[model samples]
Target: MTRRWTHGRSMRHSGAACGATSAQARITDEAHLVTCPDCPDAAEAEAIPDDATTGDPHLIETLRDARDGHTRKIDGVVVDATTAHAILTVYDAATPKTKAKIAVLPLTVMTSLAWNILRADVKREGPR
Candidate 1:
């Protein structure tokens, strides 16, 4: 008998319960994580067709749609990252953006700060 998830959009296709492949189960689990109350989310619904180089040709479009649909609506954490394209859009003023895309630009920055904070070990404390 096939075990199934009855709640969300997908109809389960697996037969065995305990022996379902770990990788498949994980994919299904991730699909559930991306589910939307209004519509299908990343893993639940269709996305860009796979490409040879990046595996999803329309990945950028998909990400843009998701970001536009976000719930909390924070101010300007990210905006479309093009200048030439911005000329045609309403966000032209928000464009020619910076490249501060990473969560933390450098992990060791704290170590540098810590060293700078020590006042060079009092200068006279070092042996000759």
Candidate 2:
């Protein structure tokens, strides 16, 4: 028996009930996923797991540490995958001209980090 159609549910749920995927379903508001039980579970089931961190304990540990409110670190230096990903996502979605402006961000970040480290070392050495 078909589940009776409801007003607030996503088209994805409606599609599922009717046994067809809808492109319209793909574009529906994300909030529906939160309020609609079946769609949320199906969406969770359909989500692709990040494979890079899946088997690597070190990467998993870093992500866990980040999620737990500690800044992520690799080789004892603070780094943030989340921020890096946000930057990359913007770059990827940018127009060509915008991409040109964004392309140097990683290098700029590295240069700033290096300069800060140098300044800290000079301060630690204390007038030598």
Candidate 3:
């Protein structure tokens, strides 16, 4: 039995009843599977969202964060992370007196396995 999707006076598809228009349906169909990267047959060129933007403080921090907990200790510099997660401090070559506090980030967009790997410290390096 075919079902109709009618929004106004016009009758849409007579098979599947969907709220989105035909273009949206197409886009959704073509959309790449995010956080499920194991599908090797999936499209390689599709674009999607990542965890953060380039200017996001946390984004830059993650790149240079204390890898495995090795404190980035600079003399006369007191690093303090008041939040639940720890943050690393980066010193500027341009300004010897300035520091940037880059905080630990949340894993919002990663796959389950990737998140696990980030959280787990097995065969760990650096800080205890």
What RMSD does each model have against the real structure? 15.1, 16.6, 16.5
Q: For model 3, state the Cα shift of residue 35 in Å.
A: 23
Task: Give residue 17's error in model 1 in angstroms.
Answer: 14
Candidate 2 per-residue C-alpha lDDT over 1-128 given as tens digits, one digit per residue, 9 for 90 to 100: 42223222233245453233555544344444344455554444334233223224344344445545665443323445654444444545668896565444343453354455556767999995
TM-score to native of every candidate shown = 0.19, 0.23, 0.20
lDDT of each: 0.30, 0.44, 0.29
Checking candidate 3 for backbone clashes, the offending pairs are none
Worst 10 residues of 3 by lDDT: 75-84
- 8 Cα displacement, candidate 1 (Å): 12
Best by TM-score: 2
Candidate 3's residue-wise lDDT over 9-80, tens digit each?
112233222233443332223224222232221222112123344235554353344344433222112122
Model 1 gets an lDDT of 0.30
Off by over 4 Å in 3: 1-48, 65-92, 96-128
Residue pairs that clash (backbone atoms under 3 angstroms), model 1: none
lDDT, residue 46, model 3:
18
> Candidate 3: deviation at residue 1, Å?
24
Of the candidates numbered 1 and 2, which has the greater lDDT value? 2
lDDT of 2: 0.44
